[model samples]
Target: MYRSNVLVCGGTGCTSSNSELIIQRLKEEIAAKGLEQEVNVIRTGCFGLCALGPIMIVYPEGAFYSMVKPDDVPEIVEEHLLKGRIVKRLLYQETVVENSNSVKSLNHTPFYEKQHRVALRNCGVINPEDIDEYIAVDGYQALGKVLTEMTPQDVIDVITKSGLRGRGGAGFPTGRKWLFAAQNQADQKYVCCNADEGDPGAFMDRSILEGDPHAVLEAMAIAGYAIGASQGYIYVRAEYPIAVKRLQIAIDQAREYGLLGKHIFDTDFNFDIELRLGAGAFVCGEETALMTSIEGKRGEPRPRPPFPALKGLFGKPTILNNVETYANVAQIILKGADWFASMGTEKSKGTKVFALGGKIKHTGLVEVPMGTTLREIVEEIGGGVPDGHTFKAAQTGGPSGGCIPASQMDVPIDYDNLIAIGSMMGSGGLIVMDDTTCMVDIAKFFLEFTVDESCGKCTPCRVGTRRLLEILNKITSGNGTLEDIDRLEELCNYLKENSLCALGQTAPNPVLSTLHYFRDEYIAHVTEKRCPAGACKALTNYYILEDKCKGCTLCARNCPVGAISGTVKKPHVIDTSKCIKCGACMEKCKFNAIVKR
Candidate 1:
């Protein structure tokens, strides 16, 4: 019964920015003012606007504060908490009404306006560590409903009707996977969750586990019942300390409440879950590899003829879904399948959560209905490319996905649509690029990651990706021929066709997509030995503009190799032989006289 509730973000993004200290300071300030009973401070999950973290929100008034520092606590406490005055200067600019003292709801802001949170519904709204807070929001009601009323087949049918697809890269049908597992009769069946989110610039799954661990736990229980499994395991990477800690807490709390262990709701059904920490192997994100890692073996992908649903997790029938996919199950069960189906496109039904990042103004977690245009996400929601930079291209699906040129920005974002445009909805990582970004370099970067992360279980991913890297290196180093470009395409096709697993099969996506869309950049790199975006050092040179340079001798002084030779008030010239291409001279030049060519 507090008059004011201060919700401080405790998610990883905010925690890194010192939100924990903000919470502690808020409590101390509240106690010193003797408003402890009247004021309540709670630590919650990510609010999705990660750019403006360590975010703080004061409820009853809903004053949204961004990038809060420890020193600012007193003013917030005295002026806003004690005196009831809004902290105008500290508030998120988007929430502040222009020319008026009034503020708008956070939902109405451009960053959040287009977002329709389904998997992220409970995130940031409740304290994930407290089971009571979770229960207050109809947390385990879906498990209760499924356990008490619906048949196992009925549960499968409802999920099948919902059109929910796996959020872990492949976009496979959730219901179909469940049905396959349910049909298989085994003495032991296993349910596994893939929290080993390895995609670059992606944190959607991690945020869900941090913000709403119960949603995933409850969903796993329902899945266990539906698939006739008593034991469940979550394969999470050791990197996500917060998610892992909160998940363990949620599991303990649920078992203590008789919601997880033994006969739940006094029914004959019995189920439980456990955690298996991974050593951060990127390939282990694959279903078979994840399960294999759980079995205490080196994480590597197993060929799929009998997929996880048919034979998995120690040679037993198993169903494995990622954290985000499980996060949606309970909702689909409670809200009904049609309710979920009504939102997304016909083929790609339900909402999709994306870890929106890179070059975008608003870099954070965003959940939107399937088929939402990339333009809507980039221009309207993400606030477009920052610093007056023109939009160039967007990379989705991490190392496994392709680049979508600006020409295809309007294409509806869905499983089929993205696949149609040479990209796939792989785990929902949307990285926006600006005009300055080199598409060829972008492809090379992703390819390098793939080459480093390859499990070495197969030659295509292990050796082929290495050969591809060499070719890209040659091109970027300003020594490549037209034949080399053709060779790259040939090798890419071979890897896609002959690879042992999805890891190898999709490894060429970045290279192939860039070659298809930004072929001019590739040709320029080979033909003219020039990186059009001036990204590759070997292909670019820095020069001081004669008209712009005041010959302040700044460039010469800043050059580490003394490459720039010039006097005060005279045009500077760079000695290309001595230049390291470090761009130090360009960075120090205040005249904006330096240009890369």
Candidate 2:
């Protein structure tokens, strides 16, 4: 055994940030110091604290190193590994206790304190590529237990008791879905895991797959057993190349170990899984669309009622659940339903994993109890709005969800509570926005995404969303009237009532929610002809604050359009007509003279 094991993040976030180079450098440094045998460097998955990547953790001591660079690796290896001294400088600030030498555990950090990581339990703790490592952490044990001991009905009962709802936006009861498929008598049945995470700022599913691929595979196997299905498919987006590679590796490893294929655990039940790559279509995230895509047809949602449980995946019975939903299955089996049920609120049991992003200090993955308040997530866990900016609103559920204004920050974040407050707990993308964000522009941004992603299967989603975009555009461009606002509301209701799929039905959420909460901003854009937050480019103008101008001619020199005209040592005047509002002058200015209004 090695004296020290250095764990470096190998997830997509860190990989993009050159964590691989840090691993290479760590190895080179250890070898150069003649301590290769003593020090072991292992590339693992996302630690959830993505903002501090490329992250490195020294085991035995468990010193969490954040934002590590290649150059810093040598000193870390030399001091931490060889000399047995912790690198205090590179340590995550949260890990280092203030006014004391003793550091708190990673779980005790503010970012992770409120979290109860059921799905993400093995994520940062294990190497996803190695089957033995997964087994060491009791990964496939749940599947083993289900196959050997529990009956299909018993398994379904456990899931039902757990109160685990689908994490894929709809909040459908997972056990009820499984029971429906189980009760259906079909010659062929299938289990599908929707890894086609298409939310704007969501990466919860991607992170889970990358960090703990075995969990999903094992869960799929269990799901297959529970629903009497022999074949399974994981419909993942092609964009998640890292998650795909790791999942394939995990599958191969499981098969080699006699965990998959015929006679698994020497039982009569035979279950197998396949990978179906999606073309990165946002609409394909819908269950019907995902199954339709798997069948080599155009990705589009079919009419529901004869849901996937009765007829799906080639007109056979199928059960579909997203990556995050499946990630919880194995743990629930091993730990018991009550263990999972005890954490969350009465209605929405079990923890919820959110891809905490946008304007937040800790922009990463967070899994907290269902009843955890929004204020706790935003202020404590997310480290509040970044740069001392006050929290204004948080956009949850991407295009299909609504914004939670500061007034409702204390609302308990559960499915019913979120829906009651005019927002649904969609795929758990919580994008924190500061006071600087314009609510109208934020709504328009989501509308733009939904409009572009509409499958056009029906006129309501295709043509209707386009009209909504037109109104948003008109308002943002300073040409909107009060009548246009009424037209927007009317069009939104039409899309919600008549759209072909959930994609269109919920497409108006962002627009509708913003209107409900921040209607004043909309009125300002139409009546006052101003973007209240100064975000809309057409309604905003950059002005040179005379008192702050140093008369250095910096603004004039940097102006790409030559909009500013002034002599050196005199205040510059900007020709508003010529100005493009590029903010180049503000960036180049030594004195804070240029201000957007």
Candidate 3:
């Protein structure tokens, strides 16, 4: 047995930061120091603290290292591994005690203390490429138990009792969907997994796939048994090369071990799974659209008089759950319904995984119980917003969700509460905004995305979203009037009511939410012809604060257009007509001289 194991993050964030090179250098150094046998170097998935990647954790001691460089490998190997000395400088600052100079466990850090990981339990813990490591951690136990001991209805009953809903945007009841598919009489029903993950600031589903693909496969097999289907399909976007590769490996390994193919676990039940790659269409995240893409047709949503549970892929009864939703299945089966149900609120049970990002410290993945407050997530878990910026608003659920203002920070984050407060618990993407963020611009950004991604199958989505974007563009460009603002509100309601699919139905959410919470900013844009946050280029102009300017000739020197004119050691003035509003001069100014208003 090895005396020490060094686990390096192999997730996408760390990989892009050259964690692989760090791993290679680590092995080389270990070998050079003759510590190869005593030290094991393994590549694992994301540790949920992505900002400080490439992350390294030395186990047994559980020494957490952040932002490791390739050049630091030799020093780490010689001092920490070979000589039994800890590299205090490389340690995550939070993991180091203040006075004692002692290193603490990563779990004790503020970032992870409040988190309750259920779907992400296996992430950062196991080597995702290795199936044996997964089995050691009781990977297939849930499927085995279901096949050996439980009937199909028993499995469904447990899931139904667990109070689990789909982690995908809609928040539909998972067990009820399964029961509907199971009750249907079909010769060739199908089970499909949605891994498209099209949300802009979201990566929860992709991380789950890259970290614990077997969980999804096992869960799908269990689902196939429940729904009486022999065939399963995972419709994943091709952009996730790592997740896709690992999923294929997991499938092959499961089949080799008799966990996936005919008569799995020595039972009469037979099931198998396949993969279908999407071209990264955002609308395919909708269930019917995903099934359409899987069926080799254009990815577009169909009417929902008969949902997928009634008639789906290949015109047969089907059930589709996103990656994060399926990741919870095996755990619920193994741990029992009460075990899962006991963690969350009365209505929303079990922990939810969120891709925490935008203007926040500790920006990464967090899994919190359903009833946790937005304040808890933003302040306690997220380490609050960085750079001493005051929290302004939070945008959840991507384009489909609305904003929650700072006033509602104390509200419990759940399906119903978010909806009540004009936001929805979307696919678990929580984007925090600082005081500097323009709420009107934020609304426009999401509207632009929706307009670009609309499938055009419905006139309301295709035409109405474009009109909404046009009005937002007009407002931000300082050409809008109060009538335009009223028209925006009216058109948003129209799209919500007349849209064909969820893509259109929820397209107006961002606008509606911002209008409710930050309408003052919107009114300022139209009525006063100004951007309150100084974010809109057309509504703002640059000026050199005369008193604050030291006139080091820095602003004038750095200005690409020579907008500033002044001598050394004197105040500078900006030629506003010549200024491009690039903010380059402000960024370069040592003194806080330049202001945009």
- As for model 3, its CA RMSD to the true structure in angstroms is 0.9
Please write out the lDDT profile of model 3 over residues 1-597, one tens digit for every residue.
999899999998999999999999999999888888899998888899998999999878788899999999999898888877778899999888666535887778889999999999999999999999999999999999999999999999999999999999888889999999999998899999999999889999989998889999999999999989999999999999999999999999999999999989899989999999999999999999999999899999999979889899999999999999999999999999999999888999999999999999989999999999999999998989889789999999999999999999999999999999998988999999998899999999999999899999999999999999999999999999899989999999999999989999999999999999999999999989999999999999988898999979988998999888989999999898999999999999999888889
Compose the digit string of candidate 1's lDDT tens values, residues 335-392: 8999999999989998999999999998999999999999999999999998999999
TM-score of each: 0.99, 0.98, 0.99
lDDT of each: 0.93, 0.91, 0.93
Deviation of model 1 at 249, angstroms = 0.4
Q: How does candidate 2 score on lDDT?
A: 0.91
| Model 3: per-residue Cα lDDT at residue 502 | 93
Over all chains combined, what TM-score does candidate 3 have?
0.99
How many Å off is the CA of 39 in candidate 3? 1.0
lDDT digits (tens) for residues 1-597 of candidate 2: 988888899999999999989988888888899988788888888899999999998887889999999999878887778787777888899888666545678878899888988888888888889899989988789988998999999999999999999999999999999999999999999999999999999999999899899999999999999999999999999999999999899889888988889999989989888999999999999999999999999999999889999999999999999998999999899999999999899999999999999998898989999999999998899898867788889999899999999999999999999988889999999998887799889988998898889988999999999899999999999999999999999999998999989999999999999999999999999999998888899999999988888799988988999999988888888899999999899899988788888
Candidate 1: stretches off by over 4 Å: 98-101
Which stretch of 10 consecutive residues in model 3 shows the poorest summed lDDT? 97-106
How well does candidate 2 score on lDDT at residue 109? 87
